[model samples]
Each structure stands twice: as structure tokens, then as C-alpha cells.
Target: MMIYTPKAGNAPNDAFLFNVKERSDRLMNYFLMVYFVLGLIFALFYGTWLIAVLVGSLSLIAYYSTKLALPNSTMYQYVLSAVFGIFMAQFIYQMHGMFEMHFFAFIGGVLLITYQKWRLQIPMVIVVILHHALFSYLQNSGMDKIYFSQLYNFDVRTFVIHVTLASVLFYICGLWAYQLKKYNELHLSQTLQMAELQKESLLLLQREQYNEERSTILESIGDAFFAVDKDWVVTYWNQMAEKILSKPKSQMLNSNFWDNFDNSTNSISYQKYKKAVETNQSVHFQDYYEPLDNWYDVSAYPSEKGLSVYFKDITERKRTELLLIESEKKYSDLFQLSPLPKWVFDVETLRFLDVNTAAIEHYGYTKEEFMGMTIRDIRPVEEVPKLEADLAKQLNKDELTKRSNFWHKKKNGELIEVDVQSRDLVYKSKKARLIIANDITEKQRYIKAIEEQNDRLREISWIQSHIVRAPLARILGLVPLIENPAESLDEKEKMLEYMLQSARDLDDVIKNITEKTTITQNFV
Candidate 1:
């Protein structure tokens, strides 16, 4: 690429020239006032105040009129040159050709230098020479009224010397003015050239910084990255790419993108990348490389010159996904084949999402019937309100719910006791639960029978303690009477007979109690 570089030179937009021009403009506004004041001051002693006013007024009118008419032009500048010379003439005439008065014309030349233009001095120099030559001739020709010099003898050599000196002074001032203007333009050009250089340097610096940052990002990223040109040439290959692809930079860079690799199986990948550049679009997709048994997430971005493709190894992610899919399949098989009366239902609608074979058999519902039914369908009508209230309560998704003795109606309309426990789960992507219901009808019947046996055993225990005690006490009292030594034979025999009757009655009571105890034991 070609670049334009600027060099320092003296040019028109010079700072010094602007300042000089400003001084010149200010001098134009008021420099003539100096002549008028001088003229008035000299007029005080000479009695020529009318000549001073007349000449001063005429010069002012001409200078100001030309300045107004040609504001943007330099015509007023030339007029000032002529007008300042006229003031010098007035000074000489007022001084009556005093030799020192000629110096005023040189001062006029110096003042003109403020304009920064040597040409403004031309008319001033011409006017001064003309006024001197004409007045000198008139004074020497016996015109005593004309004052050309203080000495009566004004020779040609003297006049020539004075003219030469005045010319040298004006020339020096004009040359100085030209040099100042030249150097001012030179300084301006250098400043502009420096500015251009700085701009170019800044652009180069920014471009270099951007390249560094881009290199750092490409190398530091976790994924592999590489770039290819429009002709399928390798351009940039980051460190990650070298490592992941197991290729060195020397082997990959500047090499044909296809030639560097086995293209037999990767033609699909190559085509994908080419299409992106051809279409001028970016594409992102994953492709499996069969040779490496690897999967890559590819992102290709197209630019005017080429394509930048990034490759990420996603083989592990793909494998994990496959494992998860297999695991879900196994889980689904377990859900369908489990022997327990298990089911899954949606929590929001209380709808049955799935049912095991056991559930369909136990609940007496067909698979199609269960599919259309909500959890409320199997619940006893009376318990529906409780179910709603339970659901209405703010329930944590992680909470376990157990309805140990809830009633469920089978298809035959028989309400059976059930021990139901459920937990939250997501089934088929729905907010649902897997529930296990245990029928407890036989258990309740057994518990009731046990309670009845307990009641009968309690009555048997009462009979043994209160009624059996009477017979045992009578027998004990009679045995002591029969053993007494002081008893007569007849009395003893009567006591024995009474004891026998008591014993017989006691035996009957014992037998009756034994039969009832046997009955109670048989019942248990």
C-alpha cells in the first residue's frame, strides 16, 4: 500500500505572517494620526497650521475612502504607501528643507514593513525621490520661496548620495519583511507535517495493538481455532488448534488446508466451511469425525478475504448424552415392568401419566382407561375433597407424601384400604410423581379378629378370679373341721357329709368354669 507522508516547508499559513498582518492592519487604522500630530506640533512655530489641516484632512479622506471601497483587496495598502510619502513631503516643507527632515521618509519605509510585504515600499520610495528632485530644482532656480535644503548650494552629488542612502534603507526593510514572511510559512509547514506524522504513527500503533490482542485471545481460548484463505490455504492456527488436532504450526501454516489433512472422510467438513465463505455467512454446527472417533463443534465465520473456523472437541459431551439416553431407557423399562402396583401422575392436573402392569391388573383398569384418568378417578368419592385440600396446601416439590390408610375405589366400586406413598418426579417431561399403593384390606380384617379374641379372654380371666375362689374357700374350711379330736363320731360323720356336698358342688362349679374356659380358648 502507498502512504502519503508530508514534509516541512515554508507555506502560506504562517503564524508570524498573521501577526505581522495584524500589526499592519492596526497601523493602517491609526498610523496616519502620527503625521497629523507632528504636522500640528511643527505648525505651532511655523504659522502654517492651515497647510497642516488641509493636507492632513485630504490624506485621511483618500486613505479611508480607498480602505472602505476595497476592503478585501490590497489597493488600500498601495494608497497608504503613497499617503505616508505625502506626509513626509509635508514634514519637509514644514521644516523648510532641513536636511534631517528627510529621515522621516525612511521611517515611513520601516512602518510599511509591518505589512510583511516588500512591495508596499515601492510607491513610498518613488514619491520621496520625486519630491526631493522637483523641490531642489525649484529652489536652485532662484525660487527663494521653495525650501529644498538648509545650505544654499544643493549639488547633484549630494542629492545622489542622499537618494542612494534612502534607497539602501528601504531595500533593507523590504528584504527583512520578505525574510520574516518566508520563515513564518516554513514554520507552519513543519507543524502540519508533524501532525500528519503523528496521525500515521498513532494508526500504526493501534493496528499493532489490535493484532497483539487478537493473537492473545486466539491462543488463550479453550477451543481450537484456525483460519483459511479464499483459496483454501491455512492462514492462522492457534496453539489450541495445534494441540487438539495434534499438528505442528510449521506443518500447518501456509499449507493447503485440505492437503494438510486426510480429506477422505472430512469432505463433509470441508464442504461446510467452503459453503460459508461462498455464501458470505457464518455457520455453527457439530460434525463427527469417524477416523478419530471424535465430535467437533464447528463455527465458521466468513470475511471478504477468507474464513475463520473454530473447532471445539465435544466428544465427551456427546458420549455423556448417549449414556443419559440409555439410562432413561432402562428407567422406563423398570417403570413399566415393576411388580408393585406403581403409577405416575401429573401433579398439576392430578392426571395419570403412566401405570405399571401390576397397577392395571390390581386397579382393574385398562391401559387406555388409565391414560385418560386423573389420580382422582381411583380415589374414593368421599376422599376427593381431602385430596384437593392436600394439593391446595403449599407443598414442597421435594416433600414425600404418605397416605397410609386412604381409601381407593376399584373398578368394581369396592372401596379398599390402601397404604400409599408417593414422591415427586419428572415423568415424560411432565411435573409428575411415581406412587406405590399397598392394599391393606386383609391386614385390617386380621386386626379386628384379634381385638374380638382379646375381649373373650378378658371375661374368662374374670370367672377364674371371682367364682373359682368360693369353691376353694369352702373345701379348705371343711378339712379343718374333719381333723378336730374333740368332735363326736356322729358329728364328725355329719361334717364329712356336709364337706362331701360342698365338694360335689365345688366340682360342678369347676367343671362349668372349665367348659367356658375351653370355649373361650377355642374361640381364640
Candidate 2:
């Protein structure tokens, strides 16, 4: 969520005019300084102290004016200042009689034209030419006596020398200005070109940054994103797209996506993307997958040149859905084929809602008949109270044990024993009991038979002890009776001893049987 703003905008002004102003300011300062020094030399040598003072005052004013006007002023202002400076220099050279006027005029004329004032030099040149011609004529016509009488006036040659020198300075300064102006224009042109190039570079950088930001945003998402041309060539591939598709941008870019990837064949993404490109319309589809059990929800949006696609992985969702479908099928099969009777009851109403096939057979009721019955309705009237108490206990407890039995009556009016297990568990988001019961009728009969057989065995043991012991007691008495005094005394004694031992053995057998019957009754 961070935003970066680039400092890439047009400059405040054009490059050309800025350079012109800068060059003009520099030239003006130089001219003012030269003018000041040359004016001082002239005043000292020619004794023209007042003229030097005037020149000094002008130079000072020009210096300050140049500084103040530099930012806003044009080349025309510097040309005017250079002209004034040339005049002062002319006055100085003229006092020496050197005749440097032509040279100075030529320089000034060239400079002025260079400063972009090519037209202004004509009038100044004509004035200087006329003054020089008149001075030569005056000297030729004997104006020398006038110079001696005129207190402040010079001779004809001196006037000619001064005018010529001033003209030369004018042309020289003009030429220099002209050259400088040309150079400045060229430099400004180069600078403007460079600025344009810089501007272009900045624009490119901004475009790159914008693309990078868009890429970062797209890649940061968990979904896969890509774009393709009408030709099915890959153009854009985001980071998530790379990871999900298992291909990098370098390998995928410009490649035919449909041809390169095996999953593309018959896949919803490929179909939608291709359709968008073919028809130039947006397309969306879900439940797309690779062979690896991965599912995707895909969308393709048509653009001017191609299509943009977004893909979301739904593999886990699809797997869960499949598992639920299989589970439902298994439950349905089990409901129809299960051997035990099972009933679904509503916790709130305690009414029977659904029953399996075995429940109908065991309960001797039709599916419709069972639908109208509740747990209380199915129980025998005599057992209703006990069943209610057991049900309440089951509701309070977490689980139900199968040992708790319910007496259910058949439609034939015969009561049957059923081992029932019921627990309070959530069914369809409501508290309900899943009751699974099995008919334990045959098992109860076998248990009763076993108990009767055990009783008969105990009766037989009692008879063996009492009835058989009576006969053995009689035989032992007979043995004592059979012992005769006519026989040896040892024989009579032995027979009596054997009778005592037989009676003791019979008593021990009776005690063992009685103890066993007591232990068996305690277990029961």
C-alpha cells in the first residue's frame, strides 16, 4: 500500500532563452569594467578629468543596471550597454591621435550584429562615416586656425581620428556581440536538445516504474495471473502464476501457452482464454483441474490486443466435495442393506423420522407405519416408565451402553427383547439421538436355557448326595451287621472299621455338593 510519486515533469521554462540572458549578463559586466579602466587612463593622459568622471558615473550605473535586469533582460539591453562602452574607449584613443577608429567601429559593428541586432548597426555606421568625411573635408579646407581659437574644440584630423576610432570600437564590439549571440544560440539549441533527451529518459523511467508497480501488485496476490495475445502467445506472467503453473516468465514469455503446457489441453482456463481471444469477449468457468487433483476457478477478460486471465486454486474444496458425495453414497447403501435396525429420532420431538430396511422387518411395521411412531409409541405399555427413565439417563450422559434393553412389542402382540444403544449426537445441526438396536430374542432364549440347565445340574447333584448316600449308609450298616462273632475277631473288627470309613466318605461327598450349590446361587 505504499505509493511512490516520481519527480518527472517538464522544466519551468525553455532552455534557449535562459542561456541568452546568462551570456548577455556576462558580456555587460565585462564591458563595464573595461570601459571604467580605459576612461581613467584617458583622463590622466589628456587632462579631461570631467569626462572621466562622467564615464565613471555611467559605468557604475551600467554595472548596477546589468545586475538588476539580468534575469528578465534580453540581448538587446547588452548591445546598448556595449555601445556606450565603445564610445568611452573611442574618446580615450582619439586623444592619443592613433586613428584606431575604423578598427573599433568594425569590432563594435560585428559585436552588435552578433548580439542579434544586425539591423541596428546600419544607422550607427552611416553617422560615423558622415562625421569622418566631414572632418577630412574640414581639415583640407584649413580649419586648423579654428582649433587654436576654439578653447575646447580639436583640429579636423583630431575630429576625424576620434570619429574613426569610435566607429571602429562600435563595429568591433558589434562583431563580438554577433559572434557571442551566435554561440549562445547554438549552445542554447544544444542545451534544449539535451533537456528533451533528459525528459524522454525520465518519461521512460516513469513508465517502467508504473509497470513494475502493477507487476508487484498482481504478483503479491495468491491467485495466478497471466495475459496472452490473440495468437495465444504469453505476454504477462505474475509471480503467483509462475509458482502455480511451475513456469518462470523467462521461459513462458512469448511462448505459445496452449502448446507448451500439457494442462492446457481441454482445461477450462485454456478454453476460456482461447474463447476470449477468438470472440473478443470475457469468459469465466470453474472446476478446472490438472491431472494432479488440483482444481481451479478461471476467468478470462478480453482486451484490445489479447486476453487477461485470473486463476484460483480450489483443489481442497473439490476434494472435500468429492469425499462428501462418496460418503453420502456409502450411507445410502448401508441404510438399505444394513442387518441391524436403525432409527433416526428428533431430539426435540422424540419422534421417529427415518428408519432403515432392517427396522421395518424387525419392528413388523411398514415404512409409513414407522414414520408416525415415536420412541414411546414403540415401547410396550408396561415398560414405558422404565424406558423413559433410561432415556433420561442417556440424555444426561455422553454415551449409551448396549446392555440397557428395551421391550418392544411386535404387531402380533408378542413382546420381543432388543438391545438398544442411543446417544445424544448432533444431526443436521440439532440435538438428536442415533438409536441402533438389534433383536436379542434368540440370545435371551439361549441364556434362559443355560440357566435352567444349571438348575437341573444342581438338582441332580443334590439327589446324588441324598438318595445315593441313603443306599451307601444302608450298605455300611449291613457290613456292620454281617460282622459275626463265630468268625475271627480280627475279621469282625476289620468289617466294623470299613463301615465307619464308608460313612465318613459319604458325609464328605454331601458337604462338597452343598458348598458347590451355595457358591452357584451366590453367582446367580
Candidate 3:
């Protein structure tokens, strides 16, 4: 999907100008061999194979020796190009100055173009010109071994034109080479630039990916989260943050943090956030924003570019916490103000955890004294074993409240009977008991007195039933006998006397019974 175009698309690389360059250096070896073979083929028809072989073999030996000596150098390419011109010259001589054979010089110049350096054509051009001028002069001066051209009418005027044309052709080839070299430089510059751009593009892609992942994580979190830069500009506001703070993302992001939430400028979170940036360190704290009427748990971290802040609305939690505090206060008041004696004790240690005012006064112990004493301290010594046994049993009991009777020893060592009411409860985070002590000493005493009085009444009722009944029966019998007199007037008089004695006896018994009844009532 990417296209790379050279800066100078019309022009080619200029390694052909110089000796073979970077990637083309090895190709020069093949080029050198081709040129030498051409020379030998020319020599075969000219009867100068010996000259061709000697020159060609010597050139190859020289180039290879230099290459082996200095492998890093490209100077060998130029040497080979110049030698190519010589090969062309030999071909011209073998053909006896054939004008068509002279085109080989230009061909050699063009072939050298692969190296992309214009300067590589210089040596070859010079060699061809010198060979032409020297051979032509010699042949014109009547030298038998030299060959210039087949044209016998070839004068100085024609010779000058001929050499001039060849020179121009070589210059043109070199010029093209120079232009190619410039194109290569531009192409290299462009290529390097493109590579650099690709590197930056890759880095940008990674940054965007990281931002996306961070945004996703922020959105997924449970806490209300928002972020601000060093300039206090809001950079991010998550869904939870918008819902909790009553500000949507569109209203928050990119806005100045202070300006958007201006009403909370006086909040502690604002000051702490600024402090975090100034110190260039992370800070964590909780703050109550008055305007929002909410609390926040915040953490701010400082970075080289800016500050990053994460915060959550803690309003609901704060509200619950305040309600819990109030509830505890209400219960504390109830416990302290209750009229009945009360105390709270730790179940595991049997130690008092708290005691009401009434408990303090009734138990004859100061609040401080009670706090230091355990439940065992307030019970009679004889009751301690029983108390332990009862507590052990209560450990497995799940009842909310229990009522029982116990004897408690006051601080002054006076013992009082009490009706104890206790319940299982959690107090100040500890499993404990809340107890109410209802004193019943006087009530028990009154109950015992009533039972004694009832016993006396039962005894009086028995006396009336058995003894007084006997006297009444005797009187009735004597009265009937006296009323039945016929020949018994005297007898009636005797019976009456007996009846009077019996009545006296009955009155005496009644008096005894009355006395006994009076004594019993007094006792009651």
C-alpha cells in the first residue's frame, strides 16, 4: 500500500560515473571480462592475437591484483573503463581504421554508466582521444605500423572534425553520468526521509493504542474517575465520574478543572492537588467538597509533562458513616440515661466493657473501679463457680434476652438479691452482654412474711372447728331435757343446775378460744 518514488525519477543512479559503487561493484568483474574477450576476437582477424592476449591478460592481472590489495576501493572500475577504450582502439587498428569500429569507444562509455559516476568516463575518454590523435598523426607521416582511418582523403581539417565529434560524444556520456549521480544523491535523501517518517508513524500508532486501552480501563472501573493535566485542564472523565458528580463528559473534558468546578475552589482537594504538583510527588487524601455536598478519595501523581489525578465520589459512603455515628450517639445516650442499673461485659473475658450511671451508683463502685473489675468481682464468692458454669452454657445459646436471679455483692460487701436481665450484643466491635439488674431484696422479705401470716390463719380456723363445736352440742342437749319435765320438776331443777355448770364450762372454753385467736392476730 506504500509507494516509494525517487526524488529525480527521470534520472538514474550515477554509480556508472565512478568505478563501480556499492551494489554494482561485483558486476565490474563481468564487465572487465567481456571487454577483454571483445579485444581478442578483434585480434583474430588482424593477426594480432598475441598483442590482444598480452594486453588483455595483463589488464586482467593488473585489475585483479589491485582489487586484492585494496578490496574497499572502487578505483578499479575506472581503470577497467579506460582499458575498455584501449580495447576499442585495438579493434580500430585491427580493422585498419574502420570508421564503424570507432563507435566501440562510445559503447564502452555507455556501458560504464552502471557505476552511476560521471567521473569514471574521464579516463576512458582521454585514452581514446590520445590513441586517435597519435595513430592518425603517425599514419599520416607515412608510418607503416600505425592505422588511423581507411579514408585516404582524410586531411587535418577532417581529422580535427573526427576527433572533435568523438570528444563531444564522450563528454555527453560523462554529462549523463554526472546527472545520474545527482539523482542518486537525491533519491538517497528521499529514501532516508521516508524511513524516518515510517519510524515516527509507528511510534504514533503505539501511543494511540495505549491511549485507547487506558480509556477502556478507566471506563470499566467502579470508582468515579477523572483526570486533570498540569494546567488543571480536565483530560478525562469516566462514566462513573459523570454519574456521581452530576457532570457529563462533554461538560468536563478539556475544560479548566477549577473553572468548571468553580464552586469547590475552597475545598481541601483543590489545595492538596496543587501541593501534589508543586512537590512533584504522588499525594493521596480525602476531601469534602461543599458545593457538591460530597466526599472524594483522590490520588494525584506528577509526571514530566503534567499531573495525572484519579478521584472517586465517596458521598454515599460518607453519608452512611455519618448515620452510623449518629446512631451510636443515640444508643450511648439511652444507655447512660436509663434509670435501671446496667452494664456491658465482654463474654470471652467476663470483663466489664461499659456501665451506666445507675450501675455505678447502685453497685457502690466508681466508673473507673467498675471498668477494672470483671463480672466475678461483683458476685458473691460462693456464686463464682455457678456464674462460670452459667456463662459456659450461655456460650452456645442463641437467645436474645434471658432473665435470671442472682445475689450481687456491693462494693461495701453488702449482698442484695437481684433479678438480672441480660442479652447478647455486639458492643464496640466485641461480642458482649448488656445486663439490667433489678434489686428484689425487699420484695422477697415481704413475700416470706405473707406466708407466715397465712399459716396462723389456718391454725385459728382449726381451733374454731374442733373445740367450740363440742361446747355448742352439749348446751343444746341440756336445753331439750329441761323442756321435757312431767314428774320430774325436781329432776328438771337438777338438770338445770347441770346445764348451768355446762354453760359455764362452755363460756370458759369460748374465752380460751378468743384469747388464742387474739394472740394469733397479734402475731400476724
Cα displacement (Å) at residue 510, model 3: 13
- What's the C-alpha lDDT at position 309 in model 1? 90
Q: For model 3, give the 10-residue run with minimal summed lDDT.
A: 1-10
For model 1, residues 213-261, the per-residue Cα lDDT tens digits are 9999999999899998888789999999987787898999999877877
| Ranked by TM-score, top first | 3, 1, 2
TM agreement with the true structure for every prediction: 0.45, 0.35, 0.46
Give one digit per residue, the lDDT tens place, for model 2 in 1-524: 11212234423233444554466557756765766666667667767667666757765775476545563444345445445534534553335434443444454455445335444565556645554555445545666522111224456677667666666666665566567667766876788799889999999999999999988889888889998887878999988887776789899999998777865677666566667777878877885554546778788899887888898888888889899889878976886788999888887788787788998888788989887888788878989999778777666665454347788887777788998876666666677777788888989997996797698677767779676677487656767456555777777777767777777776776776777676666655
**What's the lDDT of the predicted structure labeled candidate 2?**
0.68
Tell me the spans in candidate 2 whose CA falls farther than 4 Å from its real position.
1-17, 20-24, 59-70, 75-82, 85-98, 101-225, 230-312, 317-524
Models ranked on lDDT:
1, 3, 2
Task: At residue 141, give the lDDT of candidate 3.
Answer: 81
| RMSD of candidates 1 onward, in order | 15.8, 21.0, 21.0
Q: Please tell me which model should have the higher lDDT, number 1 or number 3.
A: 1
Model 2 RMSD, rounded to 1 decimal: 21.0
In terms of lDDT, the best-performing candidate is 1
**lDDT, residue 132, candidate 1:** 80
Error of 3 at 219 (Å): 1.5
